[model samples]
Target: MGFPDDTPPGLAGVLATLRGDVEPSSLWATLVDLAIRGVASVHCCKGALLSGGKEYLLRWNESSSLAPWEQEAIALLEGKRKGTEREVSLLSLFQTLAFGSKGYRKALEGSLEGAGLWSRERESQRKRVLLISLLLLFLGLAAFVVGLIGADAWLGLPGARAAVAALLAGAGVGAMVLFLPYLLVGALSSSLTDQGYRRGLQWRAAAKALKEELKGEGFNVERWGGDRFPAYSIALNLTDAFQEAVKKGKITAAPPWFSTALADKAEVVQFGALIALMTASSTGSAAGVGGGGCSAAGGGSGGAG
Candidate 1:
């Protein structure tokens, strides 16, 4: 009832009469109810029409459930007398019809195309953020691990512990000053580059192609005819080429096994299971149960020692 002034006065009057039966305070709720119960395809006979520039395009698909009574009701709504069923009989009598049933199809196709483009852009942005965060955590941990392993090996030298300690300390200082900072910078630049890769102009081009595909399908006409927007599901079949490119990148940019959080958590659980299994197996063979500290042999040749 609160629609803009552009709405037909007759339509407004009809709405006003309908609303008068409801409580005055429930006008907003009544409108909301109407919006929620948005129009559905009533009958296949009541098809959508599409207007393509100056030409009037009509596409008619008869519903299997269409009844003679419903057809009569449509004719009555069209101000036609209840008589014949065939179009040829009606056409012979009247020849001034301007619009056909296919007009609704054209309008629906354009709307669905625009929706597809919008959803793609949103998904691309979401992937970019997730990829950048992963890159950051991985590179940071790699730098930290290199620092730990280098210290462990260098500082554990045999007959020159003090000298080895001094060397490892100097190496640690150098890593903090030079290598760590470089790693941070490299990680930052690479993340930006990778995110930019997915945001390439190619995705936009693909979305444009999808829009064209929908337009070609003649699905646009009846799709947007009702109050509810119609959706056209488009499946992209780019697996082979896309996965090949991703596989090639993985050869160069694959994160270490320990870098991923999910992998690390799984590894922790697996390690516990492995230890439990080994202990059970060894104890079963020895005929002992739940004991500790079995000496393990070092792989070396020390015969007389």
Candidate 2:
């Protein structure tokens, strides 16, 4: 089958290649390969497979070096299998591959917003501490000056010089004691602000990398309200020209069993999901083959606040 007349060249081209004269077994193998490549591209997990008829298992590649927060975010995703090394649900894995870095992007966005807020707050606190410290020092110096002048005028003797010196020393010592705590607090707050700023920058850099990766894959990528808002938002519009081709009967739908078998045997369930997607695309049916349609491939946000 051929793509619809209006299909975009990028997507149409990919579908045309996939739908070329090939055996069902060969098609399945191709899908499996694509699925593995897709997962590896994001460096999230190795692959996924159906397990026990009702569940899907996603395996994490131990070789992949993930950030601590990334690991935590994956753990929080639904269908996580405890005690298993980096295994998640087939559905979750499928969503991740189909969408490409949405989960990580979302997590990074939230972290960036939080860190920014903390940095701002800490900066304000440090300023306040410095102001208070300066005020105390100034008041102490002013009082010492007054005491020196009063001693000279009232005592009118050499002994008054000693008294004035003692007074000055005591005032200096008191000022130092009062300033120390505030100075320490100011330093602490400044350090905290720097740390928060660094964290925010890290998150932004990670999100930017993910966005660039998706763009490299030919997805239409857009960033919205980042400059105006703390939580930077991203939107991905997948080239659905392939879906349009399927809907127009320009491509042949994969066999239902093909989707099922692919889902069951592939290391990553995304391959099976893509196969199922093909069935839905070709038939122009919202109904999925073995399970649901791969319509989730459409662009969407991980969310921002």
Candidate 3:
């Protein structure tokens, strides 16, 4: 199924949050979603981050009415409680993201959940997975012990049964081994309601379709348009794939919401990497701290006040 018609502004961001990783990529994806909605334009500039390296910059459009998350992002980037801005560096932008990252996510989650589109409780999700894993481990261990002690054999079927008990033991051991990995992944995973899980499958299918298109001959950009699908890719966490796909084409059809100076796929990938790096420094020193929990995701000290 397609994303709903009453889609909120940060659709990608919301979907990304449903993913539960909370990495900078989620924030990056949201930025792209906002840009596609006319909230900002993104591009790479040489002096944007460090003096020598490249980084992303967002140019906000004052005319576009803002989403709450969008407003918070801009306010954090500009270092103001409230106001509007024309441009902001992504280094500072990401830092702003890191500051209230949890608050930001919770806000989005609450809104989405209230609307019946979400049902992931992070801590509970981990706990539920952990409990299932422990139960499986206990069962496996019990089975192993019973098999080793000849309990199954004791519950005797005579000679041929001994071999059968051995098979049961092997099955238990396999269950233990298989479930061990499942436990670990699940523990680290975000839980999804049955509805959320189904929705996620749809998102995954969409991403797979986009990837197939990227690999096909004479890749068509017009069929997908510029901003919308790319925004979905970012939201889908296919950033690297989409960026690599761009490198294959001389993408001149830059969306007006993105930086127009971008000449080819390399620049597109350039900005993509910078967005990919958003999660890297999110835990940096909170040096420029002010009251109101303002801090950087990685470096800059900017937050709500």
Candidate 4:
């Protein structure tokens, strides 16, 4: 049940290793190291999260499976119960640096803006549709009332009451036909807006959390004055040097479980399969069967786990 000889360690493997019974502090340290590696990778690929040291918030705009890994790592660190002050501080530092990277920030801002615009548009459309539907409904009711008032007077005229009743019935049906579609549209628009608003809030919170964490870490954060992406840039520190080392291969990027011995072969396989399932569930990818379970750990060991 051991991983195949060709199988390489990946984020899933690192996570599996961390899932072992390790001390909380050790786990947090490993996570921090991994976060550093991730940030370093991004720095090497793209420039810093700022332009001209003052203008534009550079964010990661690329799509990769690695994005989820960073988030999961942060969540894991946050969930630790007996975490040390150092661990918490390092975790916040990692999040601030990793999430504040150019590519990551770009993606987050893009998502936030898109969701915000969509929500606002849908909300406005919903309101318009609802107003129109309500107006039609009121008009229909008024027509019905008018018909009833005329019915008593027309009753004395031959066939006049019947004609008025027919006209009112047609008007009511026509109004309903017009109202139902608009009602449905309004409901759909409302739902879209609700979903978009939620997504926007989540992204905004992530950005804000990163900003606050940087401040807590004693980094000099300043608002960019240049006409570019509205982002706060921070003073460079140890993270910049560490990223340089990572790029130069002076610092070996190790998996979270580098020190931990491999688990029982059967357990390893089971864990690999479980990771595969989880990854598939998150990414909507098809779960591979049997030996394909090892695919979860197929990528070379690097970056954040």
Candidate 5:
């Protein structure tokens, strides 16, 4: 409920993605948050989706443990309706999980709006941009046409036609400037409301704190809520923090929720590397699902893009 506590960072990634400034990695973050809440589990397994390397086993703690958008993501998983406990694979995630499920994005955005983080009338911005561009184009063309028809026909000056040509050219250039760039793209779209803007300033400071707390020197993983950090770190685009912590011996063991098949068990970094690999490899896929980029809210309070 507060900024960057332990719950997958409050869907911060979703906010920035909808703002169109970044892609999202909220799916992974959300899963980790769910796991923290004792709703899911993920561990390295022995098979691959298409390649011949390792994959992960994802288990649902309960049949109805997911959020509505989360539900939409794995809605069609092979065994969702079988029983209280269910299992799926990371390989299957490629086929499942729409990073940008419109429903999911909309729902979170709506919640943020309700919480006064941003505005909800975003569709209107797109419409307004398109309408204004079209209007400007029509007006410019109409003026150019009328001007040409009503102009003095070089009766006294041979240069009159040339002058008219220059006017038409100028009008064309003006129209193109107004209609060809960002206006036609995502014109008038705004992600921050006044309250959101105030909150944004706080989020920046929070992000800096994240770097220090998670990756800074001599940081103790156990004292830092290690279990939540590994996954949430990735969601927040601080995979380095997780990796660095492991490399420097700050993290020697993984939290219980993250495990491997080997009896001796993989090193923390190995498991982390696999997590990073799977997430990066699936970046393209997350974008297809509607995730904008690597981002997440703080442990609870703020967001990062």
Candidate 6:
């Protein structure tokens, strides 16, 4: 049957039929009837059989490396005793089953395993990047404070030594007030993202879980191995929606810290520069006032003497 790609092929088709807008569960009984009629493959102890009578031949044109159990099942199904009912275990079926060819199972497992390992490595790299960013932020604050205090002495502030201590103390408080929340947010978010990919799931399950965990809300479960697959290459991108939501919440809770720190430092520098300019202006004003007073006093003395 040439079922449209948009619709689910097997079990998926059953869902599509049931969800017609005009009818709720209208196809429910029909779906069940089809299932009972043996349109679906039934699991026997050793393998899945295309039920509904006579022995059907399944061609195995796959490469070598068929698991031992898979080879045995294929042989049993192909042998002269094919039609006879035989008991098979569920564990044996999956462990030994080949869907179409040996390559299908190998390809699927190989892709999933490779993507899983890559996700782990990607997370480790993100942690390293975030840690480095935070460390640099702290270092920048320290450098700014030191520069401010050092400038104070060169600018000839009263009790220059004391000013440096006061500036350092204030800068420490300011940096803490600005940075603590951002650091906490990044740490928490990174932790959550890291944990999300620690176990590999189909992209759809990961997306659904991520949405639920972060937003506590609705998200569609995607069908994996289809078009529009989530980027498994980057774990960070995989959970980006969740990460973005958390980041927004963090920013709302506390303004951007590193930027705040730099802003505060800029304000302090501006205030210092203003004060320096004012001091120079005031000295000139005092000299002018003193000179005028002295000239007036001398003129009066000369007239009196």
Candidate 6 lDDT by residue in tens digits, 234-263: 111232442343344421221111011123
Candidate 1 to truth, TM: 0.17
lDDT tens digits, residue span 1-305, model 5: 11443333435654434352223456666666666656665655444323434445566544465656466444544443333435555554654443444555565566666677767565567667778877777777776665565454443456567577557757866776767674547653556576665555554555556567654465755544556665556555666666777777777876556665534445475567755754564365321111111111111111100
Candidate 4 Cα RMSD (Å): 20.5
Q: Judged by TM-score, which candidate is best?
A: 5
Residues 155-241 of candidate 2: C-alpha lDDT, one tens digit per residue? 746655768756875786689778978877665443233444443344435434434544344332123111111111111112143
**Residue clash pairs of candidate 3:** 95-296, 95-297, 98-297, 281-298, 282-297
Q: lDDT value for candidate 5?
A: 0.54
lDDT per residue as tens, model 3, 31-83: 66666676666655434222333444556555347656556555554563234
Local distance difference test, per candidate? 0.26, 0.36, 0.54, 0.33, 0.54, 0.30
Task: TM-score each candidate.
Answer: 0.17, 0.24, 0.58, 0.26, 0.65, 0.21
Residue-level lDDT for 181 in candidate 3? 95
How far residue 255's Cα lies from its native spot in candidate 1, in Å, is: 51
> What lDDT would candidate 2 get against the real structure?
0.36
lDDT of 4: 0.33
Stretches of candidate 5 off by over 4 Å are 1-10, 15-23, 48-52, 63-85, 95-99, 126-173, 180-189, 212-226, 262-265, 285-305
Worst 10-residue lDDT window, candidate 3? 296-305
The CA lDDT at 291 in model 3 is 23
Off by over 4 Å in 2: 1-56, 67-69, 77-79, 82-86, 91-106, 110-239, 242-260, 263-305
